[model samples]
Target: MNAGRPELSGTFGAVSSTHWLSSAAAMSVLERGGNAFDAAAAAGFVLQVVEPHFNGLGGDVPIVSYSAATQSVQVVCGQGPMPQAATIERFRSLGLEHIPGSGLLPAVVPGAFGAWMRMLAEHGTLPLADVLDHAIGYAENGFPLLAGAADAIEVLAPLFETEWTESGRVYLPDGRPPKAGALFRTPALATTYKRLLREAATAGGGREAQIAAAERAFYQGFVAEAIDSFVSSTAVLDATGRHHKGLLTGQDMADWRATVESPSSLSYRGLTVHKPGPWSQSPVFLQQLALLEGFDLHGMGLDSAEYIHTVTECAKLAFADREAWYGDPDHSDVPLDVLLSPAYTAARRALVEDKAAEVLRPGSPEGRTPFIPEQSAVDWPVADGSWMSQLANGLPTVVKATAARNDTCTIVVADRFGNLVAAVPSGGWLKSSPVVPGLGLSLGTRGQTMTLQEGHANSVGPGRRPRTTLSPSLVTKDGKPFMAFGTPGGDRQDQWTLGFFLAAVDFGLGLQAATETLAFHTDHFSASFTPHESRPKVLAVERNCDPEVIEELRSRGHDVEPAAEYSLGKVCAVAVDEKAGLLRAAASPRGRQTYAACR
Candidate 1:
């Protein structure tokens, strides 16, 4: 396959992102002598502005980065916990079997701002104002509106006018959705950033103190106060088909702070792949790698029926385990050690037969019984508008005929000093929840990913982080930074990125070629989003896939569904050539918005 765009390479730095403006902003930071962390922080803020339909300041992000100065890879956990008042009993009392997908009830403590600030203060060379300047400018002045954002506004216009008035004020200026490619501005969002910057400047000391002050302002100061007042006082309509006030308060925001922790890692084909803990669905990628390692992926050939079946089966098994065992380790007893052990993979690998399996089978790790939450078919009122599109469609920005919402984005950057960062910024879409009054962002509906069932690893609880779908990937060759890569596909994130990795490592394809390779995923397990739907024995392959391969998969008991060409994944990646002293980057051409820059 010919990659529409070339794989970018340079010795100075390289940046890849789902949007051109974000990639350009990060690259500009690199040109200004900022490190990978600095560039990534700049890009994160810019993504919140430019891709409002995909992510926002009130969302969450999980970052995986390798710092040259520390010579270690670490995870910045930006996913916030449920409010102190949130509880499974509380939800059950509301006659809800599952967390509502949208509205204030599912809102968690907004975590993106704190996580970005933490990264900048700890690992970046630039100050808070410099890092946030690009986003502030884009939001204050005008930028071309994206077709997806316009579509989102159009879908939610009725709701905005009737219920989410705060959103109405921002997206439906003049009482209508903006046209695609028209100049659109979010002055309120720009004002929010400006206020934060002004507060940061009031701190007594240098760069670090200012960054700390900004973080405090967001979590403990005006931002928190506004969110508290809005959530506590407003009786808003949600997916439950009823009006309710949220449980989150100003204290919830104050109690939570983004934390830095060691990433879980596993070795595969001479590369050490690192991902966040079980709280995220990331380890499923490594688990798939472990199962696939037992097969001769090279012999099957890329995009072959044999290749697709094997990989799809492996993904089903891994994701089944994600539903059974993955959660916040701080809140539950997750046997991650046993789940990723070679013995576990060896046992689970046997479940992958020549044909597709129709049942959701999760293995018992350490002889402990697996608990699968009862799947419910909740007709979540995700109006036929932006909310439905964001949760039901496969990707955040693109229209796809899939059931899962991949409502997030990827950011990868590598600097000349061997520092690398990969982060997935997600949640708080313009349609997910009502925009907080006085703030230009919506609260994250991440709590919707948590189940209401008890005894499940990912059951909702006070102060517990939901088992999230957001995942960022980092890889090291010989214990040194090698590649940072990921995508924005709710449940399909690991599946899409896994295919790219196999194409690159097993088939010897370049970054761009590997990214543009045919994409596919199985809806064989429960989705992380609301309604928790699943389709056993189904495989969705891109239309670009060979017809013979599609038939071959169907013959093997797979209910194959064909998707639009270049619609499955929006992957972005950055790599370092240690021996050659070069940095490489690639962005998928799937959505026509993703871009890569290096020089």
Candidate 2:
């Protein structure tokens, strides 16, 4: 059995995140008397500096927060929408069937900055400078380069030297990839933040005004101008083996802002789970829970083949629904209420059997016909100028097929005030696009996840949000904050987090043990990212599972592949133990970089 890290418990505050530096930054904010929202924003910005390979300022974030003051949960939708100029006809005119995974062509209105500022302005008490201090410090002064970041830089060095020179300027300062563990700094990013602070100071009011000013500085001022100039003037090579200009403009950025909305919630085993709506793949997690609520998961045993098979099958069904029904509700009519209804869930649960199902089946929610995009058999384009090989992120090394290269980062925080927040910041990887010349950040390629096929729920359209895979979760028990948690695996976010939630709630495991438990996920449905590969009936299990169970699953018709032990997920979670007046936190040991802190 894998040994679990001790759960962190305290009366003050707790934080868990995918990077040690980000966790520390949040803990520092809490120690300074900042609330959970303040701490989360601090950690979010620090992650932008430290985990540039996974996320950046130009990325998107979906935050689910529970405020103790209001006793309510809200989703801060940081997911940016497609540029107004982006349309199916335009892509078709270019003879493109899908949005390119990496380049200016797939750029969206960068939404992370606006989202963080909005949350801070409304829910937090700290000044804008106070929250941004740690990030600017890390970017200006040096932090030890993470090994994964080093490797990503190394792989992309050739591409940087030849084509994306702006990225080369920031990442390959000495004309080479920096060695792992070496102190690294991005002075330009620090300058950008400092300039934003100066702009915020000009607002001449309190904390909220400053935050609002910072948001404007990013969306309408210098940052947006730099992005617009770069994208309008420069054509870059993408997955399509050619150079193309993006559709995003300064007006697109100016016109967009993050909005707060009610989360899609479900009740299971006395706990209420809240997730971002269909615009993200988050509701699928709740759907998986609703299906599993019918089964006796504890009786099946955590490592037993029955447990793994049942969970994987339910995940397949839930994700199939996600592919067929999920989209930006403003642009598409999604029958989410019917999909999550008890009758529909019961009918879908009946489809799970002893033998693994090989076909993708989306239920007709409300008797409405579901649209499943025709499976395209063409492989991702390969050419001398193509950079897809180096762009893949967060996939286990054991997997053979190419998938979404845009990985992500997570931060979950719980303060003594009973406030809780979970945020998944993703996209705009350093390798995804060329950095803006002055801004030191790349525009996110989130637009790549939107399909070009018309009449589909996630089809590309003007101002429509992509159905993203960045999902953060919040759970409340008895109308009080229970836990805030998330992980960073495109497509597998729901699968991995569902396992963690089950191990803790159903098996009565501590948070650390729950996170350490062996996890499994099926790639049976279409992926949400670019290349959008589907692996029917393939179940990827961590090697920590008993080998006997693996054979049992194989005999039951699962095409089992063993992933490296502790490689399936990197979950970061913080829980509030109201009965004991204690806050708890745990970070998975999978990545060796995640950390949790309490008190």
Candidate 3:
């Protein structure tokens, strides 16, 4: 409950969404002669097995790594692409009008595996098999489930029980969700892993191995068949289906490929920041930083009426630009030039009413909206006109929910070597598909991020990845590694990341102090793609915030709900202290436990 703490001291370390992964991978990397990148990859691989309800091979990873040797930083965008066959007309033919909460539609060519492969090829010194050894062993043997994971399993079981092609395998041992702490494994995933190694060996080059294996195993091999059949089943192909009009075909899958993009960035408060273009608000958050420099943050004080009011006011101003000018820059001319210009920043700052909350301004800015067209995908084949929720492990929730990757996980590895790897591979659809035995992995129903709306900026289209809010971030000072961090709560990721990064750099707070300081988020669930997509009616707060602070926020024109745990993007991080030659790290304290290792 304390606001400030002295933690994250060490020479090397790692963290995950689940505790088992947090400890196991850190230990494995330390055992090897490898450094942070190797350990992070190992941890990522292990998470797919042990924490499969969210994130597996079937997800995307946008990563940032810092290299001390070169004193340079690099960011890779691995978010996947849409199916080639996707189209707005496709949805009409399927009698569908909106994206489903089950995350069963708008599935793309998963890119996380490819991202990992690329990271290893360019930066990792250890062998791929070696990097993944810990994960494979956990899948083949067994790993204990953490408390939160067990609860997630119970919470999403009902939704996954009878849906999807692989339903029987995940839900039925004799047909039931496994109890908490039960050992789980997945042989299918194990085979997939081995297949990758064999492909890696015979592949023309190291780079080709990861791609070849992923394409062969998931797209062209058994996984593809299972997926194709699942997509073509009576449900998705039905005239009345709620998801896409038809299941996926080999051709659609074949059209899928991971794309590499140039990083778009800007200067804010003397720091350089980068984010993907088209559907990312990194530029907007950056502009907010530039404008906030003019404000007297210390005068307003932390979490005071003026502070929250000012931040919220600035967020509204940024959102105004976001709603109108932020979209896929390739498809539309997002007014980024004008939006990020100094003129706009100064003008917006001048409009802020210091003493009174401006409750009337909407997120949309003046002039033409720059967002590109959004089309609906086909998720047809319905026998029943009605829809229902399938619980996973009978874990009760405080919110109404469809499903996303609630079992979200993160990994940060820093070694004696200069390279660093911090990744968050996440997205889980349900609980019914229990963690399989021997595979240590779960399938991702990542279709949830797509828009069902006919012409929204974030739509399901052929050859396009959905616009995602999950971003892995890196920070550097004077061209050297300083920190790598991120969180998993959908839209809340940016808000949390923005808060902590500012606190750490601007105010020079320690890791725990920066992370634990009062934080606020602007977007409500009402602003999301769907309402009731999460547990209902809660303000998702750190349990330790002073009760009066909660009351004061409630007094304002905002809803203040208290959470006893981390809700929006559970953050995990590692920062390199060059002077000390150490890697300081910590995981979200909202969980039962998370371990950090140092040499």
lDDT of each: 0.88, 0.88, 0.56
On residues 195-295, what C-alpha lDDT tens digit does candidate 1 reach at each position? 99999898768999999998999999999999999999999877666788999999999999999999999999999999999999999998999999999
The clash count of every prediction, one per candidate, is: 1, 0, 54
- Candidate 1 clashing pairs? 406-490
Off by over 4 Å in 3: 1-6, 12-20, 68-71, 155-165, 202-216, 219-222, 233-247, 279-284, 354-367, 370-387, 390-407, 428-447, 452-456, 525-543, 551-555, 565-569
Model 1 lDDT at residue 419:
94
Compose the digit string of candidate 2's lDDT tens values, residues 157-237. 887888889999999977989999999999999999999999999988887888888888898999989988889999887
Compare the candidates by lDDT and give the number of the best one. 1
Candidate 3 local lDDT, 255-321, one digit each (tens): 5554545555566556666555545545556666767878877676665655666666676666545
Task: Give stretches of model 2 more than 4 Å off.
Answer: 378-381, 384-388, 391-406
Could you tell me which 10 consecutive residues in candidate 1 have the lowest summed lDDT?
Answer: 389-398
Quote the lDDT for 79 in model 1. 96
TM-scores for all candidates? 0.97, 0.97, 0.83
